[model samples]
Target: MTANNELFILSASHTREKLKQLRRTHQFFCPQCKEELQLRIGEIVVPHFAHKKDSNCPQLFSDGESKEHLIGKQQLYCFFENKGLTVQLEPFIKNLSQRPDLLVTTKNEQYAIEFQCSNIPIEVVQARTKGYLNASIVPIWLLKTPNFKQQKPTRIQLVQISPFRQQFITRHPQHGSTLLTYNPTTAKFIYFSHLLFIHGYRFIAKVQQLPIAHQYFPFLHLKEPTKEEFTHYWRFHLHIRQRFLRQRFYLSRKGVQDLLLKGCYGARMRLDQLPLFIGLPVRNAQYIDVYIAEWQATLLFFLQDCQISILQVDDEVIAIFILNNPDYFQDERGKDAILHYILLLKKLGVRSIHSSTKEAIILQLLHSEFLAKCYEN
Candidate 1:
């Protein structure tokens, strides 16, 4: 049997009992293609409509809906509907020729909620987002929560946010960058907020789980990481950074060509001896594709070659560096990451016209407690 749960084009939604009674006499059609739809209410799956065997609709039924997707869609529909909000399930927008899983409308905004389950290309995501934006509809993409290891609610642990998952990271005004995901099995909304990247795809983040009953339309605003929580995060970050340094020495095959290694070689410094401030966390560091150490270390090397001391570096100089090395910095915000690293250095009082004198400041910053030095305003 087809797993597709393409809904019928109807003015109002109905209960299973009502739908079953109507299925006996009334006929339903696809909203977009105007094709006949079959109502499938089985013991195993949630009640939904599907296209016939021979029907080849261009939209709605193209991608087969998974059990999780169907259940989650229905759950979200009820979740919003019960809140007395205007919500449409599998509504086809005529102008854009796009059918979002759920189109939610509030007093100020209309949002197209895409409950994505399967892996799709980034181009498809961009295209859909562009279409929604052009039609003046905000697109909120939610992913099915992956099977992650259960951790204690109080503990801070390292979680893997793969490259694909990174695309869904959205920036909120009050909170920092966050990714929202839903789990159908438990009816929970798992939020990974204030994500601080430690290494490639590995991040030390603040996670919160709320039952569907407690979840709000505009997600509940999370507070900033407390000082105690940040202390734990820094300790975990140091652990991961040490591991990354070790991996580069023994596991990595790239010798001279590697950016970090090349910088260390040029500076005549060992991996362990490298400055502590080089890999420290920066806002928008996620925009750059490489690790924090790789870009920051290379920036130092570039500064040395150009005879431009770290004390003299400014936004224009960093922008020029980003332009010169396009391969390393893919996004425009990458320049911001580099500048923020410099800002951190300035915060730590790293000032010297002489390149040789930087070691003293570096050593001081390295020996100081991370929380005291970095967290201080």
Candidate 2:
């Protein structure tokens, strides 16, 4: 929030001459708390306001703020207001019990924009987002220090992802779920879509950048990956798997790596021999408890124990794996991923998929010429 108490609410830019005309007798107050503001104009600084010494507004609390953040908020206010839309600056929503840095309303739509500059706990972030969503107001968070890099990078500098940052992710109708961030200084938004977790918290994403002024949907999916692009991606994950043996990724507890490696070694499984099936880029793999190599190796050992091959893969067997590997996936997503891989293997004539729905593409593909060769072979 700006300290421009002398200026009007929602419109903070007032010339010193204009504010000087109001004299020392001008009446102003905090927008949220309504505490009286004292107008102070100086020869050096721009005309602004200072809350009276006795004022105690709960909203005044701040970990800290930056000049860029202040200017960005002002620029955004002007950006929306210039569009002839109804906009308010630092307005407190009574019902939601939160004050967004800026709020914009267009007849049928209301949006709360938080110019997020500092990192906060995930719980606090999710709570705020949930509150706004429950109140039927869309919350949009704009990150000031976002990671932007080149070449569909596997990872940016996200040492840790705050809960607030995780809320940036959302799914689309086609391509996949994506994460969004904005750079207020550049007036641009970044879209990180089609995410695939490779190892630990790192991911390979299709990144796109566009100006905030563009009249387009931010969540629109991008094009599918070319065969060569996909091949390169799988190879990248293979490298990540190799790195897992060297202990290069995040595993919460100490000596857990020893348990995972020793468990696989005792099964007479060579980590290098594991197939891509082990670390295949299922979108929900991010929810798995272990990194790629650990879980994938376990799946391979389980398959070997059952004496199963691609031709004999059974859905029941997959369910058994889920039952046995309680730490594999977060929730029902593990089941969905199992089904996806099973369906893919069935299409390749290496396994059989028994989806009972006629409208399902997997079932239809099974009956097509693609699966006919599988049956013949």
Candidate 3:
């Protein structure tokens, strides 16, 4: 008989009445709830079992149920063992410690294969692979057929492998075949026979092959940080610094100014210092020196967002001051000034006041004093 016909016969023959007869001969428990089970097959759908009314039964399985999954796992184990591969079968790794369906090991390699019959969340699979990689073990995820169909095994299209350097295999449900490849390399999926004898079989099976056009580091596909994200990052940094060192000063605006100066004076400085400032628009360089000259004005404006309290002066609330411009302070000194300013604000409830020239000179003069104050009781 055809595969579909065979499935129909198997499903139809195991009707509620037939299951009832079997249960009468041998009592059975609900796979989900572990309560006493009663056969309750539908005339149209496949046969199923229900539990007693008081049972706390959840939906066991959507496709073939637990019994079917057990059978499938057993059959798969047999198939692999028959091929001379040492298969560690069913609940491999033990005690819910991220056990895979099968753990295969040879003289030179080891692999963890997850047989996913139902469609599970991709991220869950990815996380599992990540955990496996941390343990120095490689993972191969396999999606099995829901029921034994006569059609070809689903085409296993490899997804991603963990450690970004391992092998992975994925069997597409519809096509009934597996795609196998490794990580950190742009290798194509060859026939299963071709892969069986390859070195690092375990690691090579879990990773997806990159296309020829893609470069090694593909973070270019990641979304650009939004303005709001940049703001949050700056706030987070401020909070972290405050918690660790007891200081309060807005780093975000300063960071922007630093970036602006770097872009404006790129030719005069080394590229290593470029990242000292980030998030400034490349085109804003021309106006940067002008903005730096008006540091106090910018600080007054940004103070509102920083949530620092200010005394009202000339119809404006102003509390803090910007001591130096990006050109005045080297990167290390700028960092030191920022930390010192935060500690001073936290302790004295007063902000530092400085002209642009004093701001420029204070770093060299106050470096030792600031460090002493920071460490003093």
Candidate 4:
């Protein structure tokens, strides 16, 4: 048979019927034991065929098909009805761009029910639920299992939103709905609702709100730097410097090395190794700019063919170093150092920076104002 014909046979509902008829009519031989087998149905689990004796049965059959997905629109409608909630199945919701599984409206309150069975991307689900909330509709996520049964609806477990912060909060607590858990064994459902304070109103489902004092300058757990780690860090520092320099100037290996050595021992030392200068706060913008300017100039002196661009956004001066020669700093340290610099610059209100290669440009921009504006809206 062709491939399509085989698939059709495998998916046909009659496959299970045929197996049931065969079991009743014939005394089939045990595939493993080669002895006469007795047929048993609905013996161990839900509707299935099994052997009488626990012999070594090598062959396996599942009605020759995959189980049909049970958590469809109709199933969702029946589920809510079983909960004594009035539901309108397949309600049109424009924000979702698809019909909700069930639209429940009761006593001047309304909610959209979305039953999701498969493991989907978390961000996608968050975005969809956020959109629903923005449209003044509450979204109820009915997370079903692969084997969705009305008698044993799968319960929703409370997952930690921010494990690092030791915080647990439901996704959309303001919607006047709670996370409901369904017990398959006992056929019971439980609801959970709790309030949590989060810094930003971005549509994060499980947000762990750290202490407000550590909001901007979170204490980083530091360990003594190993030689290998220091080498990697220095290499990253060098790569970012070289990339920026190549954007403004052209330099030979000898020239680059000389410049790096000069900056390492000179002004770059004060800013790059901030922990050493304990009396002077590294958080100051002037202090940060001093280091940035020194590093930028060092790159310009070494790489003569590169261009460095700086943009002032808000209280921050963003720097972009474009490198013509890309292979100079292709290690992890170089990438990490550049990213660290961007984050530091952002914290200090020096806006953003872009480090560019021939292929792509890495951008580090702050979104505090943008986030604040989003909440205001």
Give the Å shift of residue 185 in candidate 4.
7.4
Q: Which candidate is the best by TM-score?
A: 1
lDDT, residue 325, candidate 1: 82
Regions of candidate 3 where Cα sits further than 4 Å from its true position: 1-22, 29-34, 37-78, 81-112, 117-119, 131-138, 144-377
lDDT of 1 at 358: 51
Off by over 4 Å in 4: 1-76, 82-85, 94-96, 145-179, 183-187, 190-377
The lDDT for every candidate, in the order shown, is 0.75, 0.59, 0.37, 0.36
State the lDDT of candidate 1 residue by residue for 150-208, as single tens digits: 65666466789878988998875556667889998888998887777665688877788
What ranking emerges by lDDT with the best candidate at the front? Answer: 1, 2, 3, 4
lDDT of 1 at 321: 89
By summed lDDT, which 10 consecutive residues of candidate 3 come out lowest?
194-203
**Candidate 3 TM-score versus the reference:** 0.27
Residue-level lDDT of model 3, residues 1-377, one tens digit each, is 12122211123225467665665665555433455655555555445544566556444322345544444455445545656787765333433356676677767667776655456566787788887787766676644322213323322211222322122333332321234322211121222211111111211111223332342211112122233433433343333323322221223345435543333233242222212121111111122333212232233234534554433222223213323344433333333333333343333333322111232233322233322322111
Worst 10 residues of 4 by lDDT: 276-285
How well does model 1 score by local distance difference test?
Answer: 0.75
- The local distance difference test score of model 2 is 0.59
